[model samples]
Target chain A: MVIMRRVAAGLLVMLLSMMARAELVVEVTQGVEAPTAIAVVPFGNETGSALSEDVAAIVQQDLQRSGFFQPMARENMLGFPVQQSELYYRDWRIAKMDYVVIGRAVSVGANDISVRFELYDVLREQSLLSEQVTITRDNLRDGAHFIADRLFERLTGLQGAFSTRIVYVTAEQLAPGKQRFRLQLADWDGARARTILESSEPIMSPVWSMDGSKLAYVSFETGKPAIYVQYLATGRRERIQSFPGLNGAPAWSPDGSQLALVLSRDGNPEIYILDLQSRQLQRVTRHYGIDTEPSWAPDGQSLIFTSDRGGQPQIYRLELANRKLERLTFEGNYNSSGRLTQDGRFLAMVHRSGGGGNGFDVAVQDLKTGRLDVLTRSGMVESPSIAPNGSVVIYATQEGTRGVLAAVSLDGRVQFRMPAVSGDVREPAWSPYLR
Target chain B: MEIRSYIVPFVLALGVHAAVLALLSTHWMGHDEPQRKVPRHIEAQMIDLTALARREAEQAHIAEERAREAEQAQQAERKRQERVAAEQRRQELAKQQAEAETKRKARQEAEKKRQKEQAAQRAAEQKRQAELEAKRKAEAVERKRKAEEQARRQEAEVKRKAEAAAKAAKERERKQAQAEAELKQALAREQKAREAAARQASQAVIGDIQSYIQAMLQNGWRIPSTARNGMEAVVTIHLLPNGEVDQAYIHTSSGNAAFDNSAIQAVYRVQRFPRVADIDPILFERRLRKLSVKFRPEGLRW
Candidate 1:
């Protein structure tokens, strides 16, 4: 009877094996047109030590969070090969995996470790990367992020901002009407969060420098809004401007030599470029109406800023070579906070789609083709920051009463949210590609 | 040279002789009376000495003339007789030639009869040969027709047998296919019956979970004023096995924020879905862990 039961169990397993041939792929259809299929095997640990983090899992999550890859679940992986020779290309191919990554961690010292990984093209039967790196025990997550960034760049032919960071403002309620506002910086995937500034006032309009080493933002810490630049590696910061009325929306030039900020010291809130070395001011916009939120073009030859010169809050481009101003957005009644892409071909902003400028959502406009795409359908969204590659845009949106950070692809295909663990988060600022 | 020269002279002499004879005859007639008178006068003049002699000579001449006359008359009579005999001989010869001609015509008639008989015999022989040849050809043709008919019938019989074999084979194939189809149908019916039993057993557990959750959410949901009946919002809900809601967010919007907020609120307000605990664990994991619920105010009425 026992043998018969064993035979029956074996038959059942065979049937299950046949059924397993039909894989269940969780397709993030809101992602890009075609997402790459990848498998990140559980890393082989040879150190005889209990690690705190799963490096391979972190890499997998990072790739998936980018909305460019559909990482296979760890349960579906067949083998955990630590070396290239042990890898079976046919097995990964049968699982419909386009790429496979395997790694091993070896202890090098009391606290240091050497982590090595190999990325293989299952279809091409070739190794894309096989490298080793030395890092401390706590740096495995960062090492995984670096490996993911390298893989992304190699596969997409563009630099990956996965290893970069994002700065945003988070508000926590202390009492009925009291709150604590903090400027927090974290990895692009919302991991390893660290607060740089915490105050009772608000923080808005955080912008990254060209090299991604410094941040320029408007802080209300001094009882009035002031523009300040802070170095991230070192904890050094200085107040750049404290003009009266309005000194907000500070944007860094591409060469890091100047800042185009909103200043209402004259009559109306207009755009002004301040030479950082000489501290000299150059007025860029003069209109009876409000002109603010000056964003420098990637080439630093022109500035795209929000203005109501045409009787509505529209985006306008101002050429620095000559003082000729041209209106950019003419579709909606209220279009503001225009952020140009690295090529100056696309502009992402908060736009009021319809209804007398009441419903606000994130939108991206192609400058060359004169086409506009509304990225978010839900209104009441703001502060859209574009990635360095211009493939995605992250914006601040409200979910019920809590503010959350949501990202949408420039093509309006994908949408995901990075909800804070506690408190409300807003004003997302995507950093440039970091070395 | 010799015969032409003689013929020309002889013709000329004959012509001359004929002309002279004609003239002499005419002279003699004219002189008939004159010649009688002159002979008498000549007798008278010879009178004196030889009267007696002359008389005697005259008498002698007369006698001689008479004799010559008589001789000439006899000659004329002989010549007439000869001419008459010659005419009779010529008549006899003509009668003999006519008889010979009659005999020749009779011989020609006999030859013609013989040739006619020969031609008739030859025609009869030819007719006999033609009849024999016609009979032989008919026999040969009749024999060929019999042979061909036999061949055609044999070929038809072979073709009929082939058709019969083909029909039998096709019938067998159709029967085999029908039997297979009936067997497949029986198997399918048996499988379907078993599946129906199993599904009926689990129907309450699986069906009640989704419906119960949906009902609870709908009861708590408030359709916003900005929402139309046809607008829908899809929200993805993540849950743990203990019926605790891990996360709930909107996957697709209805283009109206107030309507979307209401739908999101409904999912969150129904904090737990306890019906999932009654279902199989595998079923819950597969179907309910990450469930997407579409909230359309129009769907509630239907």
Candidate 2:
């Protein structure tokens, strides 16, 4: 039969060459962003009379300062297994450990203790998070930052700004020419800081209050630069319409009934919005150029601030319902303190790139791919804030000549340094996720 | 010789009885003349005498005296001479019987002419032996009809040479089966062109180890900011012919467990892939064992 149709066409060309060589795939797209090693271990105290606070070194310094984790090194742990049947996952997968927390604390009631933790996944030997919490030995570092916010929201599906709170503005030269500005409020890992308003004069832009209880800064104590909203559990302070010449940049509004600030008293520094129940100030922007740093837009229908109109200090966007003034940064001519990302699709700021003597860093941009990404090469970074799980950004730089507070990670692959025991920390803000 | 053939026919029947008794008597002639003359004379005399006799009687007497003399004349002639000698003996018996019938007819005509020349010499020697036995029987029937026509031609020339050798052995066999089918179709077309050149050189070494495992998985991926541009995942891995990683997981789950553990920590951060350890173990067991990967972040900023 014609040799059976040439042996069935040579078996259909060997079954189409084995269906074109079955499975090899390969895609990937792009990555190398780094950091997620984790291991925390060491918690097991079982309260044998000494449990002051270690809760696994405060969840290994809050997942190592949230630059998205690389924790390990507790003398290089091979075995502090608090439970999961004494956990041996090959001793943290031979110590290359991708996540392993473990737990213990226990002393349940004379002053209430309980703690207990778990979080595993060491390369999927799988137990992702067990949990226990109790508290009160003076809130054991707030129950170890609520177990590092449930192991950073079960490994970064994002919502663990380590129990959030930051609010900077330090200054303190205290003697040479007498400078003592304060505004402080801490714990986003500058530990429990506290002094909310001390000022020898200049206190600058503080911000936070879409329900993290209130604190709107730029204080100059009353000689000038006004704007103070305070109320943090009643260390009370109000001062809003001090319109003489520049009641500095304030912000607030994602329905805390409006605040927005920056007002050159109708002369130059534009952007206004006040409303707090119709105390109505609303003059958005007449723009003669110096419209100061205002930042609202988590959909308060717009206002992104800091402008030089076109000549230099960039960052624009106004639309308070169609008043529409849009220039949103065109890359480096000193882009100013912008802010955005709570899904506003990224916009951090304070860049400087060559149009100035090259010093101010912190850039982010992407607002749907306008692609800027210069997340800090340090040089004197400034107020860049962010982190309500926009993964991180904390800014305020200058280390050797002292101004501290650093942070980074929105894919600039994690940087650290918060250094603030005494003075020079400048304008930081980051607060929003606090229930 | 049987008596000279009866003497010559008895000497010719004695000469014919001597001429008839020799003229029998010729004799009886000569003498008798004389006597008669005498008698006549006597008679003449007597006649006259008788007449005279009477007269004689008278004379008789005279005679009687003479008579007695005559008585003798009487016996006379004695019986006349006994009759003249019986007539010469019956003429010599008829001349001896006619010479014995002419000597038996000349010896029976010479025995019928010598038996008719012997019987014509025996019929001429039986007609020359019957013409030599009819020419020898016509030359033995003409040599048996030419020997039966030379044995029917030599059996028709051996029946034409055996049909021509059975038609030349059927034509060779059919050309030796067509040259053994054409040498088996040229050895099946040279074994199908050497198996298609060894399957195109192993498909070019499996496309260079699939681009060196896609640049070692994009330099060990890290993506997870809850990685969102249609977050994919997939992983798989399983290597070890020295390319290491012997097992990576997350076969498919972008339901985000931190984007599938950042794609199984980017295959354990590329634990090894030197260049797939310089390939070809049968092209790494046919195309680098198990790979998959995928992780779709699309250069993130999600």
Reference-based TM-score, model 2: 0.35
After superposition on all C-alphas, the RMSD of every candidate to the true structure, in Å, is 30.2, 34.0
lDDT of 2 by residue, A130-225 (tens): 979888887788788878878888777667878788889888897898899888888787787888788789988888877789988878776888
Off by over 4 Å in 1: A1-32, A355-358, B1-302
Model 2 chain A scores worst on lDDT over the 10 consecutive residues at A8-17
Q: Estimated TM-score per prediction? A: 0.54, 0.35
Q: Which candidate number has the best TM-score? A: 1
Q: In angstroms, how far off is A3's CA in candidate 1? A: 69
Docking model 2 quality class: acceptable
Give each model's clash number: 0, 15
**lDDT comparing candidate 2 with the true structure:** 0.74
For model 1, name the residue pairs that clash. Answer: none
List DockQ for all candidates: 0.01, 0.23
